[model samples]
Target: MPAVNSQPRRARSGNRRDEAARVAVLHAADDLLVEHGFGALTVEAIARRAGVAKQTIYRWWPSKVEILLDTLIEDTAKRLPVPTELPTASGIRAYLRDFADFLAADPAGKCLLTLLAEAQHDPGTAASFHERYLEPRRIAEIEMLTRATEAGEVSPVLGPEATMDALLGPIVYCALTGVAVPRDLVDTLAENILRPRA
Candidate 1:
């Protein structure tokens, strides 16, 4: 008889602990990434911050950029309360205000701004940033735009993609440049694109 492989037994035990460890590592990596810009960050630094072996971080994330990107997304999700219900213009404005406050309050925002700048220099990084970070937020904004459209709050003229871009562009542009993105701007952005009822 062929010998039975013990891999399954090892996998079951390894996976749970591995998942926990990865989460811990991410928590640590996020803090460090915020404290030090990506240019100054290293896998060893993340491991040291997280109190895990560097090998563990390597096992989970291939590169520092990948790790920082993932950490930023998770951190942003936790900090920002993205409304799941259909969004009103006021609701959208509120979220944007809260998001802007979150950025202004934390060093993470600067780190993210820097990462975005770096992405311009590195096409591969830009691709990953778009796919992993920007796409999901765009989808969520599109859903909100659709809701506004349905409620007759937004004009039915602009297509969804254009609507989303118009709504999001100013906030993102201001944030990237480290300027204040006012809540009023979100309203102005939506109104310009959506032309909501007077």
Candidate 2:
């Protein structure tokens, strides 16, 4: 039998430690952002809350915004289910309606709203949010819209980018402004955007 390498064992231990610390930092960031808002979130604060050194966070993320972005991704992944099996129109309406309900129910909503407001002034932060968070959701929407367009459920003239903007932009605006769009409104919005042309 071949002897086991000690280095590989040590590397595995290190990987586990790294994974644990990373999860701690992300959860700590989520809690801090939810409890105190973005203004109070900092690498130092996250490190303190996670009980990891600040250098550990900097080694992984470039900025506080990056950490917040990760938390947003985590939060959304756990809560949002963008189903591909349903008809595209139904999927989008159901997903956005569930999203609105999540916003009404989860503190992550407040954290996301605050992060977005901050992004308006910070180009780097905004770019990170766009790439890490918004782009994936946008990609999913585009795919859904493509399916809808192929099925003739949506107007052939209605482009994915424009249709999504027309459909979802108002919901985002309402979220930012503390107005809530109910599921029926979400259905109406999706119907309007996906309505077939003559």
Clashing pairs in model 2, backbone N/Cα/C closer than 3 A: none
Off by over 4 Å in 2: 1-17, 196-198
Model 2: lDDT equals 0.76
- How high is the lDDT of residue 39 in model 2? 78
C-alpha RMSD of candidate 2: 3.9
Worst 10-residue lDDT window for candidate 1 reads 8-17
- lDDT by residue (tens digit), candidate 2, 119-194: 8998887887888888897888788778867776666346778887877677778888778776478767766667
After TM-score superposition, the amount by which residue 143's alpha carbon in candidate 1 deviates from its true location, in angstroms, is 1.5
lDDT values of the candidates? Answer: 0.73, 0.76
Q: How close is every model to the real structure, measured as TM-score?
A: 0.80, 0.82
C-alpha lDDT of candidate 1 relative to the true structure:
0.73
Summing lDDT over every window of 10 consecutive residues in candidate 2, give the lowest-scoring window.
8-17
